[model samples]
Structures are given as structure tokens and as C-alpha cells.
Target: MKPRFYDLSMPLSEKTAPFPLDTPFSRVETMRMEDGDACNVTVITMSVHVGTHVDAPYHYDEQGLRIDEVALERYIGKANVFTVYPREVDGIPIITADDVRELSISAERVLLHTETYPEYAAFHANFASIEPDAIDVLAERGVRLIGVDVPSVDKATSKTLPAHKRCREREILILENLRLEHVPDGDYELIALPLRIAGGDASPVRAVLRMYAETKDMT
Candidate 1:
């Protein structure tokens, strides 16, 4: 049977809202056929952390590997999607270690559906984020990668970014800003390759998931 594919990436455009103080996506038309140019050409500019993207260890650690240095295998493989609704703690929604422990982690790559930052064109600062203890739980379970539906793994107002730092220390790759609202909770093959940007701390990715009939019950 042919596998079904689901796009788990945010639609990147000029209106695609970026994180606070980060660069928004923009495009410039250098040549237009309507303007008598031979062909249409455009240039795009945006922060690597914009939209659906993967964060390299270097994003939080000075001695961490760059985006280009990380192995590609870490981004592509079988993954599990789980929906989690975190409760507010001190006016901030957080996914705690208990929340993670409740889920049956069957894959090396785990994508959490928080549905907090649902709108791609709207930047919501109060979106939910994973806690450092949750990161430790995933790492202890041998999870190599952690993906989320929000722009960050830590709270928007975080100064220390404990979750990001814990992930770096655990050597767990991170994929953030994923559009996982439509994806069901199950196992699927994930493909979210980052660009080979030299010395980059992060890179935008076209994340997707493949559903197979035979593997639906495997998890």
C-alpha cells in the first residue's frame, strides 16, 4: 500500500509571524516576466528559527555542533506524535515531566502537539513550552529528538532557556514550530531535514510525516 504523507510545516510567507525580536520572512522580486525580464527571480530573507525549523545544539551552547555539523540521520526516522495539554503554572502553561511520563514513548523522535501556537501569522508569546524535567525524561528514554508545536522548547520570557540547555546537554535534537494540529497520535516516519548552513545555529525545515498501514498498530 502507498503511504500517506502529512505536511507538518508552517506556511512560510511575509506574513508568517516570527518569534519576538527575530527576523520575519520576506521576499524581494529581482526580476519579473511581466516587467519584460527574461525570467522571474526572487530572494528570500528570514531568521533560521522562523516557521517550522530545527534547532542545533549551538543555539544554546557555544561549543555545540553547528546546523551543518549535526548528522542528518537524527532528523529522519520513525517518530511518535502525542497530544499534550499542559496546565498553567504561575500564568504560564508548561509541559512537565509527569505529562511526558504518561505517554508511551515508542520512537526515538517524539513530536508533542500542544496546539498553543496554532496561527502561523500570529506570534503568541504565551504559548506552552516543555519543562527541563520533561526534557530529562525524554532523554532518559533514549529519545534522540523532540519536536513541538510551539516556537520554542522553553517559555517565551525565559532568560536561561533551561529546556533548550537540557536538550543540548542530553544531545537531543529539537524541531520547533511544527504544525501538528492535524496529525493523529501514532507512529509515523518523520522527515525534517535542516539546510546545510555553515556555522548556523538553526535552519528552517520542510517537516513531514508518512503514515503506513502496517505500522499503525506496531506502536
Candidate 2:
């Protein structure tokens, strides 16, 4: 059967909330059609990690691949959405190795949908994050892509940045600040395309998911 599709990416804008350390998102007017120009055009500039985005291996590894080096298939495929939120309200929860194991996700791509959704559109300093051990589990499971609904895989104030390192070492792609309130845990086709930024550590993404059913073995 044809599956239903849902966009799981956060909207980008100068007004959107951003990380404390990074500069606030900014888009100044370079050209305005209101000035009697031929067309209405505006120059845009912002941090690569500003809105819904992906983290390349280069984000943490010195010899990792850059945003432009990422392949199309890496961000688009059948993925499993796992919800490990342990809070009553949608908040960042610590994901452990056991949690990864319980999800039974052996696919190349995995999307983590935290409980923060449906009405959560603002950024929070503390949100769900994966433990370093959880990163190991994903690497061991041969997961090539990992996504979440927060700004960074590491805590907002992480000292070691272990989560980013582990994923980078394993060549796992990281998609962050996703809008997964409209989605649930299940098997789905994920189409998350990142900007082709040359030698960039990360880039914004336009992510979408298509729902599907698993058929019995034909072999």
C-alpha cells in the first residue's frame, strides 16, 4: 500500500530559538523588491546548525566527511522511530545502551522521536540526549544515520562532547532539531536532505518520512 508522508523538520527563521553559545539566527535584507527592483530577493545568512539540520562526521572527527561529501542515500531510507522518553512532559531524557537494544533497530537509519512534540516548537536548554554508550550501541548495530528532535546530540553544556565523537567515529550521520510531533514509533521511509555546504561540519536539512508496512519473508 502507498504510505503516508510527514515532514519532521523544524522551521527555520531569524526568530527561531537557537543555542546559547552560537550567534542568534540572522537574515538581513540585501535586496528588496519593494525598492522598485525587478524581483523581490533577499540575501540570507545563518549558522549551519540553525534550524532542522544534519551533522556530518566532520562535526566531531578530524578526518570525517563533510556536509557536501554526504551521499543522498545516507539521509533517505527506511528508518525506525524509537521513543525513549521517560518524562511526563516532553523533555530531554538520557538514552542508554539498553534503550537502543530494546528498540530492535538494525537498520542503517534511525530516528529518535522524543516526547517533546505536538505543541513544543521552542528551544530548551535541557532536552533529551543519547548517552555515549547509546552511541556505541548504534555503531555496533551498523546504524549509519541517527536523528533527534533537539539542537545537538550532546547536552547543551557538554564538556567532552562524547555523543558527537562516537557517532563521528562510526561515520553515523546526525540529524537534529527535528519536528516529530506528527510522527510515532514505527518503520518509515526517511528523506532527510542536507544542504551541500562545501567542507562544512553541518548543514540544515529538509526532512520527511513516509510510513510503510513490513511484509513477511518472501524467501
Candidate 3:
């Protein structure tokens, strides 16, 4: 039987919601067949974090690796999906350490399905965020990479970014803005390699997941 797959990345376009104060996606046609050009050509402008993207340690640490410098192996591997329905406080939901420890995740990379930021058309300040201790719990369980359905692991209004700092300290990679609402909880092989942008803090990635049966024999 043919294998099943799921695309976890959000679609990138002019309407995609970007982190506040970051660049929004825009395109300008530089040349087109109708304009007598040989072929269609356009220029795009947007933040690296505009869509589903991976963050290198450079995103928060001054001496950390850049997007191009981070190993590709970190993005492609067995990944477990853990879902924790939100329980909000002050209009924001937080995933605590206990929330992650209670799950029987057995992968080095894991994606959190919080059902926050359900749509890509708008940015909401009340989306779910993870606590720093939760990062520690994931690290204790041998997680090397973390993915979230929300825009950032920290709250939208966060300035200190404790969660990001903890990830930086733990040397864990981060993939954010994933579209995982329709994906069920389970183990799968992830293939979400980021762009090799030199000196970049982050890069947009096309996150994909293959069924466990398709990758069980793979190394």
C-alpha cells in the first residue's frame, strides 16, 4: 500500500500572518509573458519567520549556530506528536512541564498540537505558549527538536522570551507556526529541512510527515 503523509507547514502567501512587527509576505512581478518578458519572474519580500519556519540558536543566542550552520539531521527524523488542549489564563493558554511529562512520547523530535492559532489569516495574542520548565521536561526526555502549532513558544507579548532562552540553553531546535490541527497524535517520520540561508537567524521550512509504517525500517 502507498504511504500516507501530512504537510505540517502553513501556506505562504501575501495573506499569511507574520509575527508582530516582522515583515509580511509580498510579491511584485518583475517580468511576465504578458509584459513581453521571456518568462514570469517576481520578487518576494518577507521575514524568515513569516510562515512555518525553523529557528537556529542564533535566533536567541549571540554565539549560537546560524540557520545554515545547524545540522540538517536535526530536522529530519522520527517525530512524535503530543496534543494538549488549552486551559487559558488571562486569555492566554500555557503548556506547563507537567503537560509534557504526562505523555508517552518516544521520539527525539516532537510537535505540540495545542490548537492555538487555528488560522493563518490573522495573528492572535492569546495563542498558547510553552513554559520554560516545559522545555526542560522535554529535554529530560531526550528531545532535540521541538515544533509548535503556534507562532512562538513564548507568548505574543513576551519581551524576555524565557521559553526561547531555555531552548537556546538546551541546544534544541525549534519549528513554529505549524498546521497540525487535522493531524492525529502518533509517531511519524518528519522531513522538515530549513533553507540554508547563510548567517540567518531562521528560515522557512516545508514540514512534512510520513506514516510510521513507511519509515519504520529507515535509519
Residue 4 miss distance in model 2 (angstroms): 3.3
- Each candidate structure's TM-score, on Cα atoms with residue i matched to residue i, is 0.95, 0.87, 0.97
List lDDT for all candidates, in order. 0.91, 0.77, 0.91
- Over the stretch 1-55, how does candidate 1's per-residue lDDT look in tens digits? 4437899999999989999999999999999999999999999999999899999
Candidate 2 yields a Cα-based lDDT of 0.77
Clashing pairs in 2: 92-127, 92-128, 93-128
Which sequence of candidate numbers ranks them by TM-score, best first?
3, 1, 2
Could you tell me the lDDT of residue 174 within candidate 1? 93
Off by over 4 Å in 2: 1-3, 86-92, 116-122, 213-219
Better of 1 and 2 by TM-score: 1
Clashing pairs in 3: none
> Candidate 3 on 66-148: residue-level lDDT in tens?
99999899999899998997667776799988888898979999999998789888988888999999899999999999999
Best by TM-score: 3
